[model samples]
Target: MQQTEFAFVLPQGYVDPEGNIHREGVMRLATAYDEITPMRDPRVQRNPGYLVIILLSRVITQLGSLEQVNTKMIEGLFSGDLLYLQDFYQRINQNGHSRLRVACPHCEGEFEVETVPVGE
Candidate 1:
């Protein structure tokens, strides 16, 4: 059997203003105990699971602790009516690399995209 992996997507902000991630969830957000904000962009959700893991790992590296990483992620996800992230990546069609797209969750503006591979 092919090894199936879980892919996670990062949004620039919350898509719905009234959307409750704890109940009718699009992304698995953090618990209510954290303080970080949620990103609402839909495109970030298009990224692969490994990319998500890698992204968070880099965050963990910066934080200098694994526990803090999860705490920060969840905090960002649970806080605010909506949140936003500037940088994000997605898997490119017919390719192993990711296509970088920049957009605001609130404005839905499109910007330049960059292609980068995972596990680099």
Candidate 2:
């Protein structure tokens, strides 16, 4: 079977305690268990916002030079990066691609753009 992993660059990379910036990472398509299991976590019950953290931690296979991807690391990501990852996760798992529809203002032409979340 083909790999379902997708690569992404964070809008604002995660800065570790050692000051290392982690920008690029890989996230796999979320399995049924990946989505359902987190609902049982007490943290998700306490803070609904934390659902994204747990979801991303489970899907992200690698993050730059990090030895492991875990909830603590996901928690450390900048808000922008977190939002980017959430969108990315939905695009890959739900839509199966990062392409988004776009329209040209001048000619009114419609097209699709493959979005990559990255810093300006």
lDDT of each: 0.31, 0.89
Cα displacement (Å) at residue 69, model 2: 0.5
Model 2 lDDT per residue over 29-91, tens place: 999999999999999999988888999999999999999899999999889888899888988
Best by TM-score: 2
Per-residue C-alpha lDDT of model 1 across residues 1-120, encoded as one tens digit per residue:
421222333333223235423212122122222112222324335653333443433332222112233423433552331221112212321222234468978999987665332212
Work out the TM-score per prediction: 0.19, 0.87
**Candidate that would win on lDDT:** 2
